[model samples]
Target: MVMSLLLALPLAVGLWLVTGGRALAVVLARRITAATAGATLLLAVATVAFGAAVDRAWLPELGVRWSFGVDGISSPLVLLTAGIGVLVALHAWVEVPPGGSPATFLGCLLVVEAGALATFAARDAVLFLVAFEVVLVPMWVLVARYGDAHDPRARTGAAQRFVLYTAVGSTTLLVGILLLVATAGTADLRRLADQAGAGLGSGTQLAVALLLVLGLAVKVPVFPLHTWLPPAHTTAPTAGSVLLAAVLLKMGTYGLVRLPVSVVPDGFARLAPALAVAGAVGIVWGGLVCLVERDLKRLVAYSSVAHMGFVVLALASGSDTGLQAALYANIAHGVISALLFVVVGGLKQRWGSVDLAVRRPALRETSPRLGFVLLLGLAASLGLPGLAGFWGELLAVYSAWTPAGDRPRVVFVACAVVAAVGAALAAAYALRVAGLVWAGDRPDPEAPRTPDTTGVERWVIAVLAAAVVALGILPMLLLSTTADAVARIGGAR
Candidate 1:
């Protein structure tokens, strides 16, 4: 309970700050963010302390319990969520401009963080769904309120699109959940996993699985379903984009791991080919669009479509290695994409525009540190061997080449080859971006002057960049923790 409150404290403080008014709200907001960050850190530590500790029941009659616990699977994600929450809050100290009160924006972020923590920690399907939906409003408010004010439509449009798409997804997910509960007579995730295969019929199970996957697919925004993402990401503020890319998107992939496989293995097996095909299409489509994207942020947004394609593909393989690769890819994408967005956000702040053609000679000679950091992030994004991005793609391809179960070998092989080509296209776009932004001669006299990165911005970029490199070098740390859960989920099939 204390652990849960620790996660919730930030939201509580954010609410207090928002209600407190603008007069002293800045100070209050900062204090709240700091306090929440501190509490989250402590909660993360306590979670490690109380490893596998299942709490008391919430609804004994329904067998729906408040049974929060962590295993190898959820622990790392919880840590990642908590860590990013702290970093984002700290980074906001310098990033957030002073016009409007920071209280509301900060409060929204805290609420989102709380929701993310709960989503990952939840052991009951009802609890998980509630936490999953709770995150949407705060994120919507963040984009709607704090996004690019110069274009008012950007905020409103982005928020509306995000909400509309996700709401549909959530509705589908809710219907699926209710169906599962009614059929199974319990929403306890652990219990459901044990009985799901034996209890559900093939047709009914497949329908529920499709509902769950479609719900998650919108969040992952796979291929055609991904139309909502680029605009939202391009228009959203830095913190908003970071959270959306790094954490919120992961929720989709996480759901695939936690729910459908656990509760509807037969359905997953039936749908894996279609899922893999969608993933393959997303990889090719996203990469192609990225090649033509003029806006730096939008390009990054497109790249997420490509990166997440790898995750979906890995999951579709239905092998232990594939599941492991999917988990690894999720973490890798979260870190690298967050770093890319942060760097692009910094560029926008300095240059006053994200248009690549308009903003020529993009490297700031004045801010060599920022330039270097941007280059490092770009390298990671392109899956350079020494960076975090490499393993996810490599492992995904490897898993596809040698799947564990009854997956179609030829299809997996073809997808792997095509995905590798997508990776090459990734290199093309990444280099194109670096060259267009950082490689040309000095800008003409009339061009806008680029500002040097601030101390705070440098700190944020450096931390993320370092993390990218560290994870790339030592993936085992993450892989070891994720393996058991991946095995358990995949083993069900």
Candidate 2:
């Protein structure tokens, strides 16, 4: 029943949002969806603490099941998705697109949440894949429908690129899943693990892992395959960017950690050197791009490509330290990126641009709290020691120093050194953004004085800010919960 509610409620809210449009007022629709999101958040949080799961057969003859559950590995992500869903819905209420269809916008949001939650909770590989594809549709709609109104053609083009890239990734992922299922003889994640990864040979594990990594890499937007991200971020609306960086990006990393790395340990080790090289490239590439970026949102967007590289590098290490670091980094990136997009989005909406030379934000003079919050996020993003970002980068670097294998010593160490260089580059761009947006001298008299952060923005930022600090101050809060599950997956026990 709990599992039923978790998946069904948000899906129902989405269906209601779309179908109830003509019958229900816009305000009513928004309220309903928002309430649903809030309730879902509560359920997700409860799951994290109480530890609940559901497994029921869906296709008895073929051995499939409508299985959905959460362990330490998945619970935090579920909570993150639910919490972000609530905030995004509320944000939509305040910044509905030009078409003025709040119901449609909010409804698609609920659908995305439903899909994300289902993906996090799914216990069967087939169910995981199904939930995974479900998230793509609503997100594409958000990108297409509420894209930047000023330039319709660019928006359409960006949306098309997003569809093209993700579709290819999804198709590749399906092929991998089919192969694993064929060999394993079941779609149950639990069964596969207990059966020692389908009892396959090292060669089979290597082949399956390659297919899975190639498929998920597109979504992770790993280096060479990452062209789709900048354009999507450049054109999508604020809510779109927030969710893309915050929730959507995690899907790929989560899939990478859970499926390719965990299910095929020997294969992951075989590919670890290549993965480390690719991750190092992404980190340096993304940071270098951010250094030259002119637009604030796009700068943050590029930073995601770099930050996500840390996650990849950590996973490639295949140690508990590395796994913990990757998970922590994943959650940190989500919150930090969301905070950035919100503030940067507000900057764009108010001043008509986030470009530094075009118009000074003058946030220091006009809105101290907004300026300070932006500063805080910048500090956190650059991996200031007491913030959420610091711990992940620190440990990922450490993981590379003493990675699991002795043979890959040279490769892992080189990646670590490159990641350090990338961090320094991250600091350069972060300070650069902070200086331009918040620390400039008072602007010209003609510049618009954007109002200070609203109650809504303040509360949202406050909650996220608190999370960043809390996670930083008490790393054990997450580590205690996750260590056991991670150990189980990595065969550390």
Candidate 3:
């Protein structure tokens, strides 16, 4: 409980600084940011040390307790969020100029990190909802205030759309939770699981499942509900984009696994086919859009939709193998997407544009190092074997071929094949970006040439890139950790 509250302290401090007096705010802001970062880092370490420790009934009345813990299911994600928080802090140390109160941005980031960690660690539905929603306000401010000012409309519009889409999803999720509590007579997940099937009617169970999934789908931003993602990614500052892709979006899928599947297994099994269809559609649709996207950031953003679609497909398969694959894919997507966003953010910072065509010809000649890094990131994104992307794709397809008894194996197999096609499309777009930007003509006289990656940027990217390669080569490290949790969730042997 102390560790959790410490994790949340930075954000609280940040909020104070943000709302404080303008005259001395800048000085106070710097102090606040330093304090927050220090405290956050310590708490993050404590969380790892306390690994999987649960404290139930810390608050009995609200049914909200310090029922927090880490597992193979959540530990990796918690580490990812904390690790990224540190890196983003490092990045801000150099990038953010002096005038703007760094306190607010850092505070918001810490808050987002706290929320994300809490979401992953939460064992209770109400606690999860609180942690999940806590992320929204800070992130919205980050985009609307700290993002690119050159296009204020784009920034504000993207933030608004993001809020609207996610809010609707959250409302649905709240209703689903209420229904579950009302029908099942308790909100405790373990208790719900024990009592759900026997107590609730099939129709009621299915309805609750659908409602919860609908809420999660929007956060997963699957296909039609995904409109808010690209614009948000395109307009958000680099750190904001990193957090959004790497941690925030996973909240949806995490909820799906933690809530519905854990508490209402039969309901999820029944809905697997429709879920598979949605995943298939998102894979195809997002891939097609990426192939045509001219903006580098937006292309990467759309690619996330495609990548996450694979995760959804795996989950929808309702097999132990599929669940494991989805877990692998989820973590892989986080690392790869963070790499892509970092590369794109670097490009935008250097060249003043994310337009692939405008920045193309000069990339090889001027920014060779950054270009090479971008290529590596894109290769990982394309699911090249021995990179982080391959395991998930391979496992997802494999699971589709051998689905659980309850699933529609034929449909899942077809979706797997379409996903394969999407993979090929990914390769095409990745190669196109590489060729157009780093392999083609000499320097474009019209476009400005920029410096190669700086020491700090190179160090940050190298860490992320190395992570991608390591995960790709040693997927077993992740697989072993996640397998038990995935099996437990699926009620498999």
Candidate 4:
């Protein structure tokens, strides 16, 4: 019952807002959305605390059940998705992009939130795919319909690319799931993990892993597959950008953990060397692009590529520390990225554009609060010590440097070296942004002064900023929660 309510509440409310409630007054619509999101967060917490689950026969002939639950692996993601849901909803108080009814826009956010929570909680392979695809339509609507009014063509293109890439990914993922189910004779994720490819031949495991990894890699937007992300972030509204970065991107990494890492150890191990190379490349590629990228929002999007590269590399290590690093990096990036997007998005809102070339007063001189927040985010992004970013990257590199016994030491060591170079690149670009935007030209006496964060916006930024610090200082809060589960998956310990 708890599980059912957890999924249904936001989905039902969102659907109504999009349809019958499309004309809801702006204030009422926002209030309703925020309230629903808050309630959903509470439910998520309850579900996680109690280990709630719901299993029912859904597709008897196909042997798929409506199985949904939370475990150590998924609990943190569930909470993150829920927490982000509340932040996005509250952000409606800050800014609502124009293109559709405010109700429809807010509704879409809830729908996407619902899908993400479901994705995290799904205990069956088929159900996971279904939940994964649930966010695509609503998110596309968000990008295309409620995106920046400044560029209709770019908005349309981004939306189309998002759908195109995700659809292709979903197809591939479906084929992989079907193949795995057929061969393994079950669709339950828990069972699959327990079986761990017991009777499957190496060739079959390789084929399944390839299909699953290929499918998930697109959503992770690994390197070349990452083109769809920057434009989408650039054109999306402040709230949309936050969700895309903090929530949507996570689904891919989580799927990688749930599917490939947990269920097909041998095959994933076989592919680890190549995946490590891709991850290392993505790190360098994203950081180098950020050094030159003019649009602030797009630069953040590129940074996500770099951050997720750490996650992918860690997962490829296939060790206990590697899994822990991947999960920690996943949460750390979520918080840090969300903070960065909020600040960058706010700047874009007030300044009309975040083009670094434009001359303006230094953020420190005009908007001290915003400047401080931006600095904090940038520092964390560069993996500054005692911040949320540091431990995850540190652990990821260590994991790759000393990978599982079966892994090729030479390749992983080389990848770790590349990742270190990427981290240095992260520092260079971060300082570049600081010098350019945080410390701009002296305020023109005649020019308009920039606005600082205030009201609801200030509160939102404070909460996220606080979380970054808390996570950094108390890493055990999250690491210990997943320790047992990480140990269970593939017996890495």
After superposition, the stretches of candidate 3 with alpha carbons farther than 4 Å from their true spots are: 21-42, 52-62, 97-100, 193-196, 441-446
Estimate the TM-score of every prediction.
0.96, 0.97, 0.93, 0.99
RMSD of each: 1.8, 1.5, 2.4, 1.1
Instruction: Please give the range of 10 consecutive residues that has the lowest summed lDDT in model 4.
Output: 440-449
Tens digits of per-residue lDDT for model 3 on 1-493?
Answer: 6555645576566566556623445455555565666666677667766763566686577565667777777877877787777667666644552224566676777778878988888877787888889999989988888878789899889999999998999999999988887887666665675554557788988988998999989998787789999999998889899999999988888888888777777887788888888888888888888888999899999999999989988888878888889888999999899988888888787768878666345566778888888888899989999999999988987887778887877898888888888888889888888887777543467765678887767878888999999999999989998887776665632
| lDDT score, candidate 1 | 0.83
Q: What's the distance in Å from true for residue 311, model 4? A: 0.4
lDDT of 4 at 258: 92
Clashing pairs in 2: none
Off by over 4 Å in 1: 21-23, 52-54, 97-100, 362-364, 445-448
Query: Candidate 4, residue 121: CA error in Å?
Result: 0.3
Worst 10 residues of 3 by lDDT: 92-101
> Candidate 2 — worst ten consecutive residues by lDDT sum?
92-101
Cα-based RMSD of candidate 3: 2.4
Winning candidate number (TM-score): 4
Rank candidates, lDDT, best first: 4, 2, 1, 3
User: Candidate 4 has which clashing residue pairs, if any?
Assistant: none
Model 2, position 57: C-alpha lDDT score: 80
> Per-model C-alpha lDDT, please?
0.83, 0.84, 0.80, 0.92
Candidate 1, residues 1-493, lDDT tens digits: the string is 7566755676677666566644564766677686778788688868866774556778888767887778777887888888788778877876774336787778777888888888888888988999899899888888877888777787789889999999999999999888888888888888778775567899889988999999989999788899989988987889889999999998888888888877888888888888888898899899999999989899999999999999999888888888888888899898898888888888888777788777455565656666777788778877899899999999888887776567788888888888889999999998887777776443555665566667867777778888899989999989999887766765566
